[model samples]
Target chain A: MKYWGTLLLLPSLLFAQPEFFGYFESEASTMQLGSTNYNFGFNKFRLDVEARPNDHVQIGANINIQQYWGKTSWDVYDFIPVDHPTGQGLIFTIPDTILLDNFYMKLSFKLADLTVGRQQVSPGVGYAWNPVDIFNSKSLMDPSYEQPGVNALRVDIPLGDRSTVSSIILPKDVLDESTHQFTLKSGIGSFDLTATAAYESEKDWQTPLLGRYDVSERNLIGGSVIGEMLGWGVWVEGAYNTLKIDIPPWSSFLPPDSEETYAEYVVGIDHTFDNSLYMLVEYLHNELGVKKQENLSLNHYIFALEGEVNSLMQDYTFFYAMHPTFDYVTLSAIVFSNLNDTSGVFSPIIDWNVYEDTNLSFQGSLNWGDSDTEFGLQDWGLIMNITSTF
Target chain B: MKLKLLLLSPFLLLIAHAQGPTADQIVDRVTNIMSPENSHSKGSQTIITSSGKERVFEFESWAAEKGKSTLTRYTKPAAIRGQAFLMLNNADDIWSYFPRTKRIRKLASHAKKQKMQGSDFTYEDMGGGDVFQKKFKSRILTEETRDGAPTWKIEMSGIPEEDPPYPKIIMWVRQSDYYPIALDYYNEKDFNTKSLVLSDIQLIEEYPTAMEMVMTDNKERSSTTMRTLEITYAWEPPKGFFSERNLKK
Candidate 1:
């Protein structure tokens, strides 16, 4: 009864008018994966709130409400499963699906900042690939889209005008199970430099039989540098990770139990011409990736699905170009290629600034190659989005 | 005698200056008047397309050290609500923070010439410094009067080594105050491409502020207008307020 009363008071928050804003968006999408064709779409409402009740403390939240079309009816077991339970589920029961993307509090001091609760921590310089980040996964289709939040405690200390040292700790059931990272950033003679060290948890599930196959952890040290050279913007990001693996008995070609070190790196450059034409190119090399198409196995696919790695191929390239075709219309094209497999996905996008705070966008992706290839497993996809804000 | 003096006013205004202020001195005064000691400004920019459609963006901007450093944050148009831009050394150093991507991107120094947010203003214009004086040479062309007010017609030629955004700039300076009331911009081919008109002037805190500004594309028939909603020359930023950590926040 008390919780219900508090829920009723949520609407009264509008009385204070503490910088409340957000947007409403509707999207339709269709994709063909392998031989299966799927069509889906949803309407989403995101409400962002920022409040300062005092001088030194600030609080904020990003709440989302979404409903999917052609899927109005859902079974109760989806969200409120009648199986094992947790303390959060026991204390608060939800009758509907509500998502809280960001709920955090920050305290500002003269020299440093302390932040706690669910927040986003993004660290990298690469456009399509970030080798040092483990807090969230990026969508290749929408590389610049928003990131998901993770629960953590972060502290930032400023060294000078353009230098900072940040420490973030993500706790789990026990201290031994937590993930922690320390990052240092500074500017050196027109260049932005970053260095980071982290301890992250990793796991993998084997195919044919859905079972917890290999569970391990990794230690990563990485850095990125961005600067201008010969009138072009250039950057390089790379990470070296050490991990222990367990080889399954059924996997004959797999190596025996051993601890190994691998590196993931990206190099990119961009330039915008005087005529307003923008172009960028990037290359990624993953040492753990499969070198030959014949060596590609189900375990590699599972590794990608489990977020253990971003790509299954050893080498890849990304190219993008954008130009304004009209006063209100902009056109862009992107190509992501797997160099090892000779397969790729080409996407063309268009954005129209319809009116104040309103936008219309259309994006399409076409895959090229055989089914045995990486991107070829997905045939084609298209999405249309209409968004308006207050 | 009073009637004769009043009738000769127009002719006197056309007379050339003898050992008076040069074009460089006039430009120096205008730059100083435009760049205050310290400032915090809140404003809006409205972009009108050739088809008569309009898009508005609201922003809060801060600058210090005679426009050597500047920070601008956009609050309206939800698409870019939490976007912030920081520039130092007249845009020789630039950084952009995107709330959606939770990332900070560094732009090349040469990117100052790119159009800013689909508006007529470039990053160079937003730099809010004496970049023009540092990149070009100015000379007085002729003396004139605008609306019965004494004015100076000045011509600016770009220095090739600086790689200036425009090849030429023509300014109409109001003599009463060191303010460029009107300006015309030329493109690479030295064609008169855009013209800027300034109006709605006011005096606040002993500083001259232009409340309204409009830049029009002569051939495209489109324009972008900026209006100052609130401004203060007394505001001072705390130490490290313009740092990257604050920008990310």
Candidate 2:
């Protein structure tokens, strides 16, 4: 009863005269593997409210409601499930969840802006991959999805009309200094440049499933640039991370304690032709990634699945193309290749503006490789979605 | 003698008012009135297809250096909100900002031929006010009446080496205020492709300004109407406001 009371009062407390807006989306998807097929359906409803009570203060919030049901051939029961276990079936599950994606208040001053609460901060210039995105990791399968926000306090100060300095603090508990980040952004001539640094305490690291280990403090430095060269849009981004880890004493062929540095970088270019066709190509190099199947063990794969490390191969290449085929329709294609293992995913999409503020999209992805390669274990998939905003 | 001199002064004033401005002077005056040193405006555009489907978009715009540099930001239509375009001083390169991606894209020069926001107006139509004077040579054809006012019918042709979008344009300029009342654009094949009509003339800052404009695409059977909601003249924006930094903001 107390939680319900607070939820009812949230809107009144946030705004005196608020503006309400959001969207509703419904999707149906299917995956094909050999002679068997799996299907899923979901609906998402979101509501957003924003208000400026005065010249110096502003508040905003976003709430998401999702309901989904699916049946798959893969073994998903081995991991912890986010849904309530009410159904009686081996390959079927229904999940329902409600979440607050963003809730923040901003205070504006003469020289700075301060924001507190859950918010999103993305500092990279890459289209398909963003190695410098330290605060939040985005899904490569659906690059257009809105990233989840982080609970933090942020401040931004303007050095001039073309430059800004910003800092963020993510507290784990009261008076904790577990995670923090700082960034500087500026425009030099036609180029937009950014630099970032972050620090995280060791207590935040989770224990791996296979071994007991202690992790030390971690530090990160990253930079990115976006500009035009020879009539083409070009961008480059990179990051370096240093951390110390103490391996289990029983582990063989590994040191008990070691400090390691991992580096990652990406370079990309894009051009638009005379017929309004857009094309892009990008290459990525990740030093922490495995190059061959023999170098990766089941424990390491489990660590990658648990999000303890970046889930990518040593080298990758991406290509994209988009064309407006008609007045109301657009066709696009994307390809992501794991160059180290010679595996890749090819996707084609179509978008149609059916009506005002309404859109329909159909997309499909086909993966190909050997059994041990990156793309071989994934099933071919197709999805159709309809979205409307109000 | 004083009475006789006062009577002759009225006749002298009439003679001065009777002499009309030449064609070049009329074009120059119109350009000056349309392109101020700096200005800001809020407006809405409504596009109507032949099947009677309508879509509306709202925007805010700022311009400096007599329309040599301009910035336009869309504020309505959730899908395109916060999208901005920055064009430098008559440069062929134009920059576009997408809020979702938080990236700036430089459009090629050939993009001028594409439709703007699915509307009938081409990108070239929204370029700037000085496009006509910079690309075409004007000649007065005749004196005619348009929209209940005496107007000069003028014919303008593109320079051979410039290769402008339109081969020729026929314009009707109002005699009283020198504002362009209507324009018909022709392609290289001498076919009329588009027509623009201006209405609701009002005086702001001692200059005649059009509060409403309608553009029609002849081949597509579609039209777009733009209405100015608010306008201010001589409001110079701060320096660096048109830079790439502001586009991201």
lDDT for each residue of candidate 2 in B48-144, tens digit (9 for 90 to 100): 8766778899999888878878888998888677789887745354678875554565554555556677787766677666767878898899999
Tell me the deviation in Å of residue A215 in model 2. 7.1
* lDDT (CA) per prediction: 0.80, 0.75
Candidate 2: Cα lDDT at A224:
85
Q: Candidate 2: which stretches are off by over 4 Å? A: A1-13, A72-95, A173-177, A203-216, A243-260, A299-311, B1-30, B50-52, B68-71, B82-115, B122-124, B129-176, B181-195, B217-221, B234-249
RMSD of each: 7.9, 6.9
Off by over 4 Å in 1: A1-17, A33-36, A69-97, A202-215, A245-260, B1-17
Interface RMSD of each: 1.4, 3.8
TM-score of each: 0.87, 0.79
Q: What is the lDDT, from 0 to 100, of the residue A358 in candidate 2? A: 85
Residue A182 in model 2: shift from native, Å? 2.7
